[model samples]
Target: MTDIKVDHIIETDVLVVGGGGAAARAALSAAQAGANVRMAIKAKWLTGGSTATAFSELLAIAAAIGHADERDHPEIHYEDTLDAGRGFIDPELVWTLASEVPHRIQDLIDIGLNFDKQENGKLVQGMSDFATYPRTCRVNGVTARHILVALGKQIKKRGVPIDENMMVFKLITDNDQNISGALGMNMETKEITLYKTPSVILACGGAQHIYKHAVGTSDMIGNGYAMAYELGIPLVNMEFIQIGPAAIKPSMTLLSGPVWKTKPILTNSNGENILEKYVPENVSIDEVYTEKVFPFTISSAAYYLDTSIQKELELNPTPNGGVWGIMPPGSEEIVQEKIPKTNGVLKAKGIDVFNDPFEVALVAQCMNGGALIESPDGTTKVAGLFIAGETAGGLRGPDRPGGNSLAEGQVFGHRTGQAAAKHAERSTNSANPEGKSHAALEDLADWIGRSKGKQELNDAIVSLKENMYKNCLVIRNEERLNDAMTYIQELEYSLENGEFNIDQENFSAAIDFKHMLTIAKSIVLSAQTRTESRSCHYREDYPEKDDANWIKSIFVTQQNGEMSVDTRQWPHHRKSEKSEVKL
Candidate 1:
């Protein structure tokens, strides 16, 4: 084994491994709890992760503060979330998110995060799909960015050390399987650093970028999921990834909210009305458009619209790999009024919504599944290692309601940060494990010693992404999933055999390929194992929900140097104050 030198060793009480909204919240809470906190981000602070990059006209955080409608309550929010999850959501997590998000929102407000309000000084709230009332809180459609700005300011105020351009690839555990520290590489200097901490929070977001068509930032490539999975953490609901319509041509912005209400004409590359051809006879275009809000789900007629576009692109290939959406001449004013943010973004890109045809495609937006947490505090089965944000699963289900993603990050980020700090306070074994550190360095050295050019590695990533997009996006089946799994395994074999080239410049890419392959295989295998059509994970072979045998959540784990798949019954029977909602 080639010896690799560790350039630096840093010590902290709690190490946060992401820079998104969740990570910011975690770091802030940890610092507030009086724990020495440090953050390692693969990209620049406040410039990466889904929370910083996600945008839409209706972008808001779901909180049942009863601002828009007095009828709204946490119970209603919990019920709607449970129903939307399609029998796979954890009841406790849903309740925690629904009940505690209001407090978290208030915390944000207390920290100088201003939400949009009406003339009466009442907060403005809008209704999102799968929501009972107008409970989504927003600020001119860029709510996430505003939230991040507030969070970034608070994070800076707390004096938490943040390490940017640091890619954490390994989680070091002691002999008792407790998290001791982590190993990271600085992307700029190519130097290795070991962070010694008693507690760690994995909030690195999702791997939607593994798909060819994704809306998340490039840094969100499954670093959290892969690291947790490698550490024997069970990943749940890996198959249920949320995908939705977004512009692919002029700019990569989400096509949601009032844009659908405008009744824009959707066409194939040849200008054929694809929706008319594929929408069921019983479903009208008006119904499809009305039902379409954001993410693609099998329960609604809007799926026909997404399916039509997918089929059209497959049959008649477009240069941009999307269908054209043309807004009516007079509807431009309505779009400008209703979806002003989306309209402004597109207008800046030189595509007038009234005249030019915009390219739209089904883009992977978020993952509903991730490392399964045992509590609302984002506690995984692994000791001293917690998860939050998109990195933690079981909190969401097959379909997450719009705006809940941001709410979930705050609710659980606060909880996880506090829990991790408490755990760190009780921890006595803060010493770095030399054995694990040496092994991690040896592994890094092996990769560096096998370094070659970057072309082959780049080609492999492109091919994997294309395959994942084609086989594992909105629509899926057993054959395609199996084929994808096989291809992924072949890629894994090639990577192990050093068939693809890797070098120092592309070392992050090489590590990303490994993480992507691990996550892709997990998704494919989990999708195949489910064998039922539900929510975002629609298996065409089994075209309907099999409630009898498939009401359980699928879990993927690494065991004995191979992938293991299993399922566990959801805790639907767990008693709670709001347990009246049934599957």
Candidate 2:
């Protein structure tokens, strides 16, 4: 058998992986800093990630919104974020992001990206949350993607070497745990790419796809997070997950979650106004509903608020693809005709989103925290590696406040890229960071050439996704989680031990599934550790938030085949003493 050789060795001051907002920022920042960088994202050139489809970004344009009296400075934004995080976030990171985000976003605009504007030409902020002011800013209602498109064009113009359809098999390193380089496979040729570089930034989104019915795409299998764990990085707050704002995807045309106007009458199928049941504090219509329901809803049905009283005209938040889509912006006729699929889903499930009372589950959208931040410079505990964006934890600790994700990506992504570039500039090496032995190197060489034939990678990938969707979705218990985990593990094991084929279509996909399996286990294991109910770490056995002992982040690590977890209490934010945090 012929062995596949390293196609080519490329050296760079930095390597930024993934195409989401974080990676875009990383690539642009590093290149602007005069570092040679290579960018890679899984899957092909189209729809690479959820951020690709993310119509909103909460960070880049907050203070520039249309609301004339909006008091949105980074400081106020920081506090609101801290409060939303439940204080589990590392104050340093939160403070850093909050302080610089407004400026950072403005910088993005200055760099050729344009945010959507109102009739008066002010930057438009969508109905976003997490601050005393409106924060989610968009360009024609698509924030990150717009930024992504711009960055892609700019990066291309600069010619800073990027590989499309490149699957990151794993991070390659030497004995010192310094990230030397990475090994990837090209989707077109089914070839192995073992490129060595000094520093790397991992911005590969989150592993939300590990769960069934995820708001994210199947590509968000947490490869970066899983690879970090495999290579000895401490992942933090893996227990905190975030379901979305609505029971259905915003992309859904017909059936949609209620609009803000319907809050006064929001109810579940059981005829309960969720806001009243949870807050009991007679709040106004504009308060974040997640903040009200998250504490208890995790252990119970997600959201079943009563909205029976709202007039038909004022309730709708639906959209069709592209622009000019109505968000339940009109009357019931729009929903009935345009997005009847979702409407039918609601009606079939006996949900009356229109009536005084209706129930809808805010499906698990994404994970908020994971892979503890060990670097003040955004470095993981791993020497040669860095983590940014959603996969890297320590942004918001307790619970992620709404509208802060895009900011963290931009701010920390900038930091991670710069720091990594500096590290690359200082270092000079061409060996694996983990000191791969001769035998290990030989094994890698052997595995590179070992595939035989008749492998259906897509089938396995589909099965894994379907299983995840079915078993690990909105609600779960030990029995179901365990079953799903086992099934996933078996599939991973089969791939590892099988002798079917090489370079076959399913080949790289199988590799992807392997990574997905690791990520899936991380989710299940992390979920199993936090016995106390809080936020998305809901437990059927225990249905109440026990801040007494469970406020800490659940940390997980895996070695060989065993997984262990350690918990750390949520950081204490002394709200009484206005101890200042400044830009």
Error of 2 at 361 (Å): 8.5
- Cα lDDT tens digits, model 1, 1-583, are 4456678999898999999889889999999998999999999988888988888887899998887887788888888888876457789898899888989988998999889998977789998888989989997668998998898898888888999999999999998899999989999998889998889999999999999888878777898999999999998999888888888985588887578988889888777888888887888889999888677888888889887878877887567898988887778677867777778888888988788888888898899899989999999888899999999999787778878999999999999999999999999885556678988777876976765434488789889999998988878988888889889999998887677676666777788899999999999989989888987878889989888998888989999989999888776734557422110
Off by over 4 Å in 1: 1-3, 450-455, 577-583
Model 2 misplaced regions, further than 4 Å: 56-70, 117-122, 244-302, 305-330, 333-364, 430-460, 499-505, 574-583
lDDT tens digits by residue: candidate 2, 167-215: 7767877767778878777887876666678788888888766644455
- Best candidate per lDDT, number? 1
Q: Could you give me the TM-score of model 2 versus the true structure?
A: 0.77
Best by TM-score: 1
lDDT of each: 0.86, 0.62
Q: Which 10 residues in a row give candidate 2 its minimum summed lDDT? A: 317-326
